[model samples]
Target chain A: MITSISLPKVEKKNDPSLAKFIFRSIRDAWDYRWAIETFVTNNLCRRYRRSALGFYWGLLGPLMTMITLSVVFSMIFHIDIKSFTVYIFTGLLPWSLISDSAIEGSQCFVSAESYLKKLFIPKLFFPFVIVGTYTVNFLFSLTSLLLIGMVLGFQWKLSLLLLPAVIAVTATLILGMTILLGVATVYFRDLSHILGVTLPGFFYTIPIIYPAESIPEQFRQWFLLNPFYYVIDLYRQVIFKGQSPPIQDWAVSIALACCLLLAGLVVLKRNEQDMIYRM
Target chain B: MSAEIQIDDATVRFRIYRNPSPALKEMAINLFTRRSSGEVLEYYALKNLSLTIHGGERVGIIGLNGAGKTTLLKMIVGIYPAFRGHVHVGGRVTPLIEVGTGFDLEMSGRQNIYLNGTLLAHSRQEMMEREKQIIEFSGLGEHIDTPIKYYSSGMLGRLAFSIATMIEPEILLVDEIFSTGDALFVDKAAERMLSLFDRSQIVVLVSHNMNHIEEFCNRVIVLHHGEIVNDGPPAEMIDFYHTHIAGRGSNASTEDRSPMNTDFSVASPSTAVSVQEQSRFSMTSSLSE
Candidate 1:
């Protein structure tokens, strides 16, 4: 592995082929697996370090958001729908996973200035840590939502068996986006600020608060263009809607994730060496 | 399968930007106007440097500030990629540069031990095995559970030092992290460092301390303005470096003399002794060794 040994790892000026870049990257990640584990643990620990509620806050925060949004839309706005709390809960959970991870991941390299300056850490390691930490948090909220949804007269379907696959696809999508944004943010520090402003726009436009059908028929095609909508829809199909999504949806979601991941790897490979000096 | 490092015709250039990164607004404006958003001051940090260190060579690198001393160490560590030429390293490199650098302040001293161990690419089980030794050496005791942010600088240094030294390095790279902890801890650290040096196949030490170079290194490379000015035995290189580089540079300005003199007293107690006279004693002793 590249991280384990220092020899045969020549530092040259030319960029390697994409296949070479990916192969070496995976080896580096595997070699630094313990680091990823430690960073994720530290990240989660730091989040709840001084909080009185601790890990319970992870469960309660989403529950409280579901309640507030359900009350606002169902009771106040009177936009009546069946199992509305569970519906929004399903949508908001995945949406938060994507947006929150992206916002944090965009600054992963910039924030790791201290570590990067001093060691030979794999460039992909930071984004992997972000994705790992967020996925754990996502799983926690998912468990709470499942119990709460069941209590609210929502039926569980065997389609829930597909939830793991859905999460894999979504997490893959987030990891790709995180790596891409993280590398870009190193060269352009404004990318994180841009994400802060634009991610909320994504939250509004991606139909997280309302069902996809709620969009007017003329403007609905734009929703199909969004890469995130497919991943979120995959979750809603399995968890909230209690039905198996079409194979085409699965194909599209997986393909989108693979493409982003490829792009992210490409950008990272090209800029990996230059990134240290840029920082 | 001994350790080796070959840096051939390597040129590491650094670009210092007036604005490190361009803002989005500035980027957009530059795109429209076809204007450069910032002025870049580019220069070579390591200029056409070619050097090779084989197994069992305890090499010392010495130079004035901005002479690419640390840059050379970092380049070999693969932290700084060369802009030109090739750098081929032939063993596991363990850089002791900024030992406690990436410690998470919010984590406890014990937790940081594992965190730092993993960062150095040691496995969890490996760290677990050394956990007792590390904690005992750090001497943080019950304070190991408390967040490291609350620890005094000396305590933090001790913890960082203990964790960093717990490695069986094949090619050890040291960059002046010697002066940590109190007198007692420094003695312990120096002993540990000497043993580590003895075990490594290749050792490259970068220091302004002439005494350390004379004592520990068999071979010495004197870097001047990113190029190797002299490469020879430790005593000879130290004498050449002091007269040609440090002395000339110091005479040009007094600010450069302090770093060369800071650790010079360990070699000789008398302030009246000249650098040449001090090196002459070591020349005879090192030749005999």
Candidate 2:
């Protein structure tokens, strides 16, 4: 004789689990704010401690690169100087900001493995500090860009009001990418290698040197799909064209930034514990 | 405040993946056959171990290497998670897992004091209040301004110990970090440990040194291969440990002795004397003794 076996059914609850998780992440970050601030300040001071140039080095690298690039592209390629210098500077500023943030953010946790293993501080701050420092570096370059624009006889206009909005968009986009790449770098270290190769290619593809109109009609839609294009286009519109970004472009970029931010937060929350083992 | 640190059936398990390296051909084959042995390895670092530690109790944890002593301490301090059971730590935990683990070698000692103190959860104002006391205890005087990389291991250990012990945490979790300094520093450290016990109710010390275990801890827990074999007063536990070691030594010698001499009397006297000496030394070394 055989008896039928019955397993107990588990009850499923309908709840906003993600909201709870995000709330916990925010709480954890709040608890570890002191540790994060100390870590960042210490790291920043340590990097410049032995340097002869001190923080002047921050301004030096971008200025040298810009001068070299402007000479080669403007003089040799016979590029138009009327708005091209400001255009290139604007694009380069944000691109470098993103690239520097991405590279440093990806290595943050891996380098802090010793601290992470011994303490239970929030891991999000590693990427936050990396991006925060690079943003400071980017701000220095932005000042130089403004100075160069004035030197090139470009008129400053009210479209500069759109500058804050553009910065918000750039920060949002970088924050999302930083968090995502920071967590992913712990797992697939190969992602860092892939990013190193792809980032430069990405810059060239985004029309930092040329206008979007230069793209063939057949390829225009394909070009618009690249997120960096929208970011760089907004920079050119404000600084060179003296016009604010279109409502449609602003809406699309904001939505994309929000999506990436939320997605990155989700990934970071899920992998918070696993990060210890991976790193 | 109650000084008891209670752990009830706490278990910590880790899941690790074991993936076979798949060549291009293997990947293609697996796409169809799906016969690869992709498995997960589950390891229990600490099994269902429970302990109750009361105020003024210095408990020592003894085990062979990799017997989960460090894991247990880390869990108590909430550095690692427990897979099952409850841990109720009554007060602030200061874990001195390693001397100078968090010290930045490039930073000056004064700067590192702020950094280290902040990481240990002290506010700037709080650390500032204790600044004079910490420096005095460290005994580094003029060297406090120098980069920590210039400091010797003993100097680093002293700085770390002074900073850590200065916080006056309710519960202190110490690993085998006290062996870094010279005899003078060791005496200073011992004095500091005794002072910490005046304020800290529970002190969990993990060390391989039997003398340290017997001296500092009133009660001892014997762990072997991830399980607690005995938990009792230090005297009985030390005796059990010595007898167990002696039995293993005698058994090993009996197997390889001369062909004609099958008697086990040769391994008895010396083993007995060594065991007695060890126990006597442990008793005298005990803080209560």
Top lDDT model: 1
TM-score of chain A of each: 0.91, 0.85
Structural RMSD, model 2: 10.3
**Per-residue lDDT over A162-265 for candidate 2, one digit per residue giving the tens place of the 0 to 100 score:** 88788888888887888898887776666677788888887878877777779999998988888777777787888778887789888888988888889988
DockQ, in order, for the candidates?
0.37, 0.24
For candidate 1, what's the TM-score of chain A, rounded to 2 decimals?
0.91
**Best prediction by TM-score:** 1
Query: Which lDDT tens digits does candidate 1 get at residues B59-144?
Result: 99997766777778889999999988889999999998767766777778888889889989999999999999999987889999
Runs with alpha carbons beyond 4 Å of true place in candidate 2 = A1-16, A80-82, A158-169, A242-248, B1-8, B14-41, B52-57, B84-90, B124-131, B244-289
Question: Clashes in model 2: which pairs?
Answer: none
Each candidate structure's count of clashing pairs = 0, 0
Look at candidate 2 and tell me the lDDT of residue A252.
Answer: 83
Q: Which candidate's DockQ is highest?
A: 1
lDDT of 1 by residue, A92-190 (tens): 889989999999999999988767766889888999999999999999889888877776667888999999999998888888999999999988999
